[model samples]
Target: MGPLQIKELLQQTPDGQSVTLKGWVRTKRESKNAIFIALNDGSTIHNIQAVAAPGQFSAELLLTVTTGSCLKITGQLVESQGSGQAVEVKIDDIFVYGTADVDSYPLQPKRHSLEFLREIAHLRPRTNTFSAILRIRHALAFAVHKYYNDRGFFYLHTPIITASDAEGAGEMFRVTTLDLDKLPRTDEGAINFKEDFFGREANLTVSGQLEGELGAMALSKIYTFGPTFRAENSNTTRHLAEFWMIEPEMAFFELEDNMDLAEDFIKTVITYALENCKDDLAFLENRLADEDKNKPQNERSIPLLEKLNFVVENAFERLTYTEAIDILLKSKPHKEKKFQYPVGWGIDLSSEHERYLVEKHFKKPVILTNYPREIKSFYMKLDDDGKTVRAMDVLFPGIGEIIGGSQREDNYEKLLERVHEVGIDPETIWWYLETRKFGTAPHSGFGLGFERLVLFVTGMGNIRDVIPFPRYPKSAEF
Candidate 1:
């Protein structure tokens, strides 16, 4: 009838039936009597081989067959005589939809570096590495929705443009319509945001948590999956200026219940990827293994498949932030004077400290809770001692803190006090504070950086590579 995707064709029991295939030509090899072409339609990572006899097409038509050329072919589906694939198409007719210039094309048949591929972000999807990565990314996203849906969690869509900073770090991208060349100023000489769009200062949301609490208060359990922006000037491999976050907020769930859900959620998605994305994960596993072999013996990593299985099978270590701090203070890194930021109480844990806990000491994922109130956000539930809040951070082996969440403060006065303590005006987020005043509950939630999870699952070192188009400081090209 019409065209069959290469993914579907590769799985069929070849019976020499006629079929139509449409895709880009990945590679072509010429012989005196025949020309063999590998066709890919982005339906799957595997390519289908097509054979053309001497008289099947003109010499001029044959010359157009090159990498990246789009083609439509009618052929006979027969069992392949080749080694890697199961089926091949014996072409009866061929048509070139478009042809890529071989003299100027960036993606050659040879293996290219990830850095080089990133420069050509628009075309990187056609490569085997990115193709497999994107497939796995899709699988992971599906698993996220399936896991939450199966657990009775309602998916909530919060506002992308918010008036208040949920994180309270003050690192936010302002969304304004005011002209910079000609500004409207107050009599006090400050630029008046009242003249701007929305009649008040607004920003691209750093999180959807504050609004998610309103949903959780009534719905009992709710989650958010959307894009978030940060104004941090970080250029690290683990950071992105714009990224996707999955935030799950639940009513009546404490820090312990939050940890249970987080652990289960992570394990479920990893297991789903392991079972469903076999071909893609295998390719990534092999890629990581090859890359690791080039590193020093001490810096080399375990196989990706084994690492995934390890996370699926093991129970995450749960401990208090104080306990983790104690372990770090007595750790060898501290004694040997190795850590760049020295370990002590009341100080925030650096990436080095987090990696030490998960990678070197525990050798499993860790859930650290009850962080000092000064180190955490203002919305976190205050402990009885008033010194710490019910904040939890889940740290993985390679990447440090993959999740950061807390039990939200249900008491309006305590939340207001904390807000004022953090130097944020209470009038700005009166809507969020109203939720606590009306129907308060012991609500808890966490923000999981989706790209970080993908990075961990795919064994990718750079955060930019996992996302389709990463936005970072000074780099938003394509």
Candidate 2:
């Protein structure tokens, strides 16, 4: 049989069963009579301790058993005398698969700052904190698929590179094969995109919502979970140049249906994590608590588990953008001039404003809908007042807007007009517009930034920490 995983072995009732295990050494402690090695195989947050009697292994072999070293061991499982763990491995034989240089290994057996870990992200997964985060990330991703699949939503793979900008923000990475040194130009002296690879300007997709809508139109229910790129230059705790998006588009769904789906979806996923990732979440909860001890009480976050449970158990507060703005205008922070940005009806809500609405006022997740038309995307269905659109943003505590969606404008004339008003050439997105021309049905969808969800669920303070390899401004290392 293959070597038993540490997670599996830890749960077994130790009846002197001989077992083979393989994993990396996390730490080594030497006593006068025996040596103890903490072994982990990335299966779980907890490590299994392997005890070795001195002289059972050669001194040279013992010297090779350092932190971060990979090993295979044949051992007999027995009840542990330790306080923390239930069982321990009594090492009968040990083999070093690879040795990490004691002098060069960066991850020593100690607490590491998140910033320092990011520098060595290629190897950070070996650390307990990152390993736990990655495990939770995996569980959440699996939950996302299971949740959608069980609901009869088809998984749709949208193009990573396309000619259309889904968000129309113009912040996209260009995909080009044209040689800059010998570039062809139009008579107007602009670089000729016709001479490029696709015979037109192509960019990494900023979202899959537009393509996902086409799938929804045919399939009735569709979801796209894939990498998305944005060229925004912000270096905040919440931004990433390249990230994953979870966009679900449903046909015959109105703004109310969209809101209902978003709420149920968020709650369901969080509940899954709470049930399946208890150990990892507990580790992260303690980690956050320890970190928060240094900050002011008001600045510290609610305990991670409590925050998550509160979200799962409570119903999200729903209000219109106008109502949310009114609450903010009457809030103590706004009256006392504590808000950094101005709060008004036509302005887009910033992270601070969003957090205040969720963390301070509502004390639960909030879904703010019917945003002013000018502040929202052009595809949103316009309200009768012509001043607002059927847009929704789901705001969470600690993290601001976790999900943003809208009921799409189904009328061909209004959509085309909005397209022109936004200065987008109709010819560029003729295919998307053609959907409305042929057989447009009322549809609603939302885009959930995958890293942001991971960030929230993992209780990670920075967006970069949750994603394996984070891409951001001026940094793409490993």
Best-matching candidate per lDDT = 2
TM-score of each: 0.98, 0.98
Could you give candidate 1's per-residue lDDT for residues 307-338 as a string of tens digits?
88988998999999999999999999899999
User: Model 1 lDDT vs. the true structure?
Assistant: 0.92
True-structure RMSD for candidate 1: 1.3
Local distance difference test, each candidate: 0.92, 0.94
TM-score winner: 2
Off by over 4 Å in 2: none
